[model samples]
Target: MDGITGETDSLGVHLHYDLGNGDRLQLLRLATVAPDQPLAALVPLDGDGLDRLEAIDRLLRTLLGRKIPQDTRLTPQQRRRSRHMLQAIDGRMNGASYRDIATALFGADRVNDHPWKTSPLRDITMDLVKDAFAMIAGGYRTLLRRRHRGS
Candidate 1:
């Protein structure tokens, strides 16, 4: 979303999905974490398997109120929100803190010039923001891989 992060990291990517059901899914795609990695290897800090990807996908579809081919929905309103949110997110693409992102999206007033608080105007939840970024990063990585293979 931020022009600052016009590209993915050298090693991995991140994705965020906001299902309409009020459930948000955040996925971090490591540089080496291919989509087909054995499920056993996706353990979190507590060694728990990341089994929420499907649930996240389902939630995101529900949020869209319809099934769409791409990760993002196509309705006018949703598209508008996505565009604004993406742009705000992009402004912070260069590894900004969560508070900084909230401020950029919600503005300084909603954020009250504070550094640690969240901005009220922020529509997308924090988790969804995280997931969206992961997805974008992953897409970039996949693109690079394909380009390399073609070359």
Candidate 2:
């Protein structure tokens, strides 16, 4: 009998089974199995008229062929943006006005010509401040937790 092996990784899961009489099967989880599918209903003792090994192999092939779920973690750029937003929040807490923070971060030109209430730069800066405060309140913990889980 040939040796059989199975492996799972970020891409998906794979299984290989060898029957002693030169037959072999390879199964890959590329998609989820449907509840009403024949393979989903397979059991060890209920092979119908097919060979037990063959039935098992078919069932495994169908069941295992599913794509691995994609990771939804933040990208490096997003993390950097979060850090910058936190810095803006810190600036606000330290007595800097919205215009001051905007000038400091985005340069004087972006803040000098526009009225405070209507300035796009001010709006963006305020949004960052809000996001930063949200992070401080609890959202930052999610990042820390993800880091620990990933490690």
Best by TM-score, which number?
2
Q: What is the lDDT, from 0 to 100, of the residue 131 in candidate 1?
A: 53
Off by over 4 Å in 2: 1-72, 145-151
Candidate 2 residue-wise lDDT, 31-124, digit = tens: 3643243323334554232344444554455446644343335677887788779779989999999888888888998787888789999989
Name the weakest run of 10 consecutive residues (lDDT summed) in model 1. 142-151
User: How do the residues 65-135 of candidate 1 rate in per-residue lDDT, one tens digit apiece?
Assistant: 66744442245675565665576557667777656676666666766654343434443536547656765
Count clashing pairs, candidate 1. Answer: 17
- How large is the C-alpha RMSD of every model relative to the true structure? 17.4, 16.4
CA shift of 5, model 2, Å = 40
Q: State TM-scores per candidate.
A: 0.32, 0.45
